[model samples]
Target: MDRQTEFVLRAVEDRNVKFIRLWFTDVLGFLKSVAIAPAELEGAFSEGIGFDGSAIEGYARVYEADMIAHPDPTTFQLLPWRTKAGTARMFCDITMPDGSPAMADPRHVLKRALKKAADKGFTFYTHPEIEFFLLRADAPWNAPEPLDSGGYFDHTTLDEGTDFRRDAITMLEQMGISVEFSHHEGAPGQHEIDLRYADALSMADNIMTFKVVLKEVAVGQGIRASFLPKPFTEHPGSGMHTHVSLFEGDQNAFYDATDEVRLSKIGKHFIAGLLAHSHEITAVTNQWVNSYKRLAWGGEAPSYVCWGRNNRSALVRVPLFKPDKASSARVEYRAIDSACNPYLAYALLLNAGLDGIDKEMPLPPEAEDDVWSLTDRERSSMGIDTLPRNLENAIAVMEESELVAETLGEHVFDYFLRNKRAEFDEYRRQVTPQELETLLPRL
Candidate 1:
């Protein structure tokens, strides 16, 4: 066994870990798990545990039923909440019965995209400022009520939810994840926790852990932690505002000493590529029916496809760096919501940026003003594009993009489009209460 695997096994034994949960994700980025006894750890490291892939969503057909999950030893960690049973967890990679890489695996999709970035001497790092809501449980799939009346960093009345956030951050640190900042967001009971920057793969794994930890802490405190993008109509929606940068060895490829906005040539190209493919990759970044509700015009969220410095209304914003902190310089993409699959989202994002670098695409002029307030003609004159309004429009653009098809292999791309299209169609057929309220009385 590799040294990492051996070390993980030793740690498990030392911790008295009885069960080791093998964790993975489907195409939509939903976490899947299977538990094995601690004794089977060595065998699983050498030969993966077998499972039927055909039953899993976006995995395989019945003809290709046999699959295996090979755990990554470096990701081994004890479940902090399950200390009574002494359970450990490790993320796994899916493989075919023949020991070949599975094309449908989301982790493999991300690795393939990362390999493309690596080929050009680049490494992608991401920091996600994840926003979520603490709510009472839903009665019957209906919207849940917020647990706090506070808004935008409010600290009034020192509620139990405040204590929940504080304790949750402590637990997160105990599990080896760092939280850079946490505060109340613009909406009621909506909170954001910003994570430290890490490589794309590690950040993806951390996101899963963060979600699980948040929910566990919420449940312990008798509340529900929700990552739903648009849970309420009048309230601001939750988002996963992601900051990303590219590195070459130790140097930040996105930064330069002498440049406007302190962005390098490569950085400009990356921004351009992101804007170019923004419409195409919308389906992956905002991968749900409710996602577009958060992207609506007039909200603080981005609706126009333009890059800027310190402008939240733009799809991509370059955060200004202090005089001494060049390495901290990076662009934040505001289009992604909390509901997306992090692996697929990062893959398409990196791929789009790299495509710009390969083609030497010129960056568009920055929009310093609020582009959301402008009329259609004004926006057009500014050379700014808009994102797809909904899932249907987003899928239409995705279906036509060569970049999307190439980035997400044929299998995933096809599966995602078919699934999303069906979703949009179902949504269209459904007559909502809003429609009923208006049409029923009038008719």
Candidate 2:
């Protein structure tokens, strides 16, 4: 056995990790888990546990039913809250019965995209500022109770949820995850915790852990924590505004201190590619009907397809660089919501950015003035395009995009469209409370 596998085995025994949960996610980012006894873990590490892929959404069809979950030893960590039997967890990589990668697996999607970057002598790194809301357990979806009436960077008396957040950071630290900073967001009860930048794959794994840790902490405190894109209509929606950059060997490929935006040629190309394909990738970034509510909000949510330096309104921004921190010289994509699957989201992002580099796309003029204020005609004249306003619209754009299909692979492309179309159809049939209130009396 490898050293990492042996270490995990030893840790499980020493920590009394009785129920080891194997974790993975569907294409839509919903967490899935299965537990195995400690005795079976060694066999699982050597030979993966088998499951029916046809049963999983966006997985294989009935003809290709068999799949395997190979647990990644490096991800093994004890669930600090699961003291009943001292449970542990590890994320898995899904593969076919024959041991080939399952194309529909989101992790595999990212690995494929990363291979493209690797081929080009580059590696992608990401740091996400994940924002979420803490609401009272009984609070309605549209009317959530704020744990704190605090604004951006507000520091007030510690509430139950505040204690939960503190415990969450502590638990995350214990799991070998480094948190850069944590603070209250602009909206009441909303907060953001930024993770230190790491390779794209590792960052994706961290995101999964982060969500579970947040929920575990909240459950312990008796308040519900939500990562919903726009849980409340009046307040700012939660965003996973992620900063990304590329590296060539040990040097930051995105940094060129002399350029106008202090961006290297590769960085400019990457930005151009992302902006050019932003609309194409929007379906993956903001993947739900509720996600549109956040994207259309204009202030923090980026609606216009433009780039700027230190501008929050633009979809892409070159964050102000600090001297002596070359590693921090990167661009932030403000369009993505917390609802997205990080694995697939990162895959599409890397694919889009790499496409720009391969094509040597030129960066467009910066939109210093707010692009959201412009008329439709004005935006069109400036070559600024808006993202799809709804899931239906986004899916239609995705269905037509050759690049999206190529990046996501055929298995995922077909399955995702079918699932989303069904969701939109169900949404179409539902009569919301607003419809009942307005149409019942008037129509």
Candidate 3:
């Protein structure tokens, strides 16, 4: 057995872990879990635990229901919230009965994209500033109530949200997930947590774990947490403003010492690729119906496709470079929300950036003014394009994208498109509260 596997076995025994949960995600990024006793750990490491994939969303047909979940020992961590019988969890990679990687598996999709980057001598890294809302646990879904009314970075004494964040960060650190910062966001009840940067695959796994941990912590505190893109109309939406960079064997590939902006040619191309393909990939990054509401609602989220050095209004922002810290130089893509499927979203982002590098795509003129302030005519004249106004439009654009299709394999691509279409259709048939309040009495 490998050293990591042996180490996991030893840790389980020494820690007295009675239940080991095997965790994986479906196509829609929902966490799935299956628990096994301690005695099955060795067998699970060798041969995987079997499950029926037919029941899973976008997994397989009933005829081909047999699937395996192989635990990744590197991801094994004891659950801080579960202390009764000593529960531990590890992220799993799904495979078919024949031992081939499942095409529909979101983790496998990311690994494939990472392998492509590896072949080109590049390693992708991501740092996400994830935002969410803390709401009253007993509040109704449609008329939800915020737990607090604190503003951006307000250090209110005796704040419940603050205590929740402290506990959440402590638990995350206990699991070896590094957190850089936590603060109150602009909107009431909304908060932000910035996780330290890591490799793409590990970061994706961390994001999934981060979401679960936050929800679990909220439940323990007798409150609720939400990652919905646009929970309230008047408040700014929750977003995952992710900073991404490429590295070449310990060197920052995005840094250029002699450049005016200190951004290398490779860095410019990466931004160009993201701008060029942002529209097509919007369905995956901002996948829900409400996600478009956040993008187009004139909030902090960007609606136009453009990049700038310090302009938060633009879709991509290149943070200022510190003199001695070349490693910190990176580009932040702001359109992604905290609710996205990070695995597929990261894969598309990496592939699009790599495509730019491959094609030697030119960077466009940076938007010095606020993109939201510019008139439509002015934006059009300046070659600034807006993202899809709604999920239907986003899906239509994605349907014709070869980059998205190739990055997400055929199985996932087809399933996601169909699922989104169904969701949009269901949404369209509903009579919204706005419609009733606006036209019901008048009609």
Candidate 1 wrong stretches, greater than 4 Å: 138-140, 321-323
lDDT of 1 by residue, 226-305 (tens): 99898888898988989999999989998887886788999999999999999999999999999998888356778899
TM-score of 1: 0.98
Task: State each model's CA lDDT, in order.
Answer: 0.90, 0.89, 0.95
- RMSD value for candidate 1: 1.2
**What local lDDT does model 2 show for residue 229?**
89
TM-scores of the candidates in the order shown: 0.98, 0.96, 0.99
Instruction: Put down candidate 2 lDDT per residue, 275-370, tens digits, no spaces.
Output: 989888888998888888898787989988999886888999999867346777898999998788899899999999998999999999888877
Q: Model 3 segments beyond 4 Å from truth?
A: 321-324
Task: Write the residue-wise lDDT of candidate 3 on 1-443 in tens digits.
Answer: 99999999999999999999999999999999999999999999999999999999999989999999999999999999998889999999999989999999999999999999999999999999999999999999899888999999999887899999999999999988999999999999999999999999999999999999999999999999999999999889999999999999999999998887788999999999999999999999999999988997774799999999989999999988573478988999999997889999999999999999999999999899988988999999999999999999999999999999999999999999999999999999999999999999999
- The weakest ten consecutive residues by lDDT in model 2 span 320-329
TM-score for model 2? 0.96
| Weakest 10 consecutive residues of candidate 1 by summed lDDT | 136-145
Report lDDT (Cα) of residue 66, candidate 2: 94
Would you list the rank order by TM-score, best first? 3, 1, 2
Q: Sum up the clashes in candidate 2.
A: 0
Give per-model CA RMSD. Answer: 1.2, 1.5, 0.8
